[model samples]
Target: MLTYLFMGIALLAIGFAVHVLKWNILIAYYNTKPKEKKNNKNTESYRKILGYYGYITGGIFFLLAFLEFQGISVPPTPVTAVFIVWTMIVMYYAQKDDEDEK
Candidate 1:
C-alpha cells in the first residue's frame, strides 16, 4: 500500500518537474548526452509525450493505492503490462528519426 503511494507521489513529482519545469535531467537516454548536444528545441514534443506518460502512470498508481486502501486486492501484472506498453510507445516517439526535418 505504502509502496504504491510512494511510487505515485514520486512519479507525479517527476511528471511535474519534467512537463511544467522543463527539466530534462530525469529523462533516460537524453540525459546521458553532452549538454552542448542536447538540442532540446528538436525534442520538446517527445519530452511532452514522456511527461504525459508519467502523469498517466502516476495516476494509475494513485488509483491502485486508493483501491488497496479500500480493501480491494489488485494484481500487479496488469500495472506492469501497462507500464511496458506505455514505455515502448514513449520510447518509439522519443527515438524515431525526424525525416521531415531533413
Candidate 2:
C-alpha cells in the first residue's frame, strides 16, 4: 500500500518534469501563475533546472518504493530528511538564479 503511494508520487513527479521539458510552461521554478506564464524569464535555464530536479525526485521516490516492495526496511526519517534538505537546496539555487537575472 505504501509502496503504491510512493510509486504514484514518483510517476507524478516524472510526468511533471516531462511536461515542463516539452512545454516550458506547464510548471516552472517561479512563474507558475497563469498570468505570469508569458513573462517567465530565463525560461530555458529554469526549465532545465526544474526538470532535472523533478527527475531526480521521482527517481528517489521510485527507488524507495522499490526497496519497500522488496521487503527492505525503509525508514521514513531518513527519506524525509533527505527531501527537506533537497528542497531547501533546490529552492535556494532557484531563487538565486531568479534574482540574478533581475
Q: Whole-model Cα lDDT per candidate?
A: 0.79, 0.67
**Each candidate structure's count of clashing pairs:** 0, 0
Model 1 lowest lDDT segment of ten? 93-102
> Which runs in model 2 stand beyond 4 Å of their true positions?
1-29, 32-40
- Top model number, lDDT: 1
lDDT (Cα, tens digit) per residue for candidate 1, span 13-79: 8888888898877877777766765885756765687788789889989999999999999888887
**For each candidate, what TM-score against the reference?**
0.80, 0.69
Give, for candidate 2, the lowest lDDT window spanning 10 residues. 24-33
1-102 per-residue lDDT for model 2 (tens digits)? 376466548655655754464565454444454565546656666666666777677777877777778898788888778888987898788678877876
TM-score of 2: 0.69
lDDT value, residue 39 of candidate 2: 69
- The per-residue C-alpha lDDT of model 1 at residue 45 equals 66
lDDT score of residue 90 within candidate 1: 73
In model 2, the clashing pairs are: none
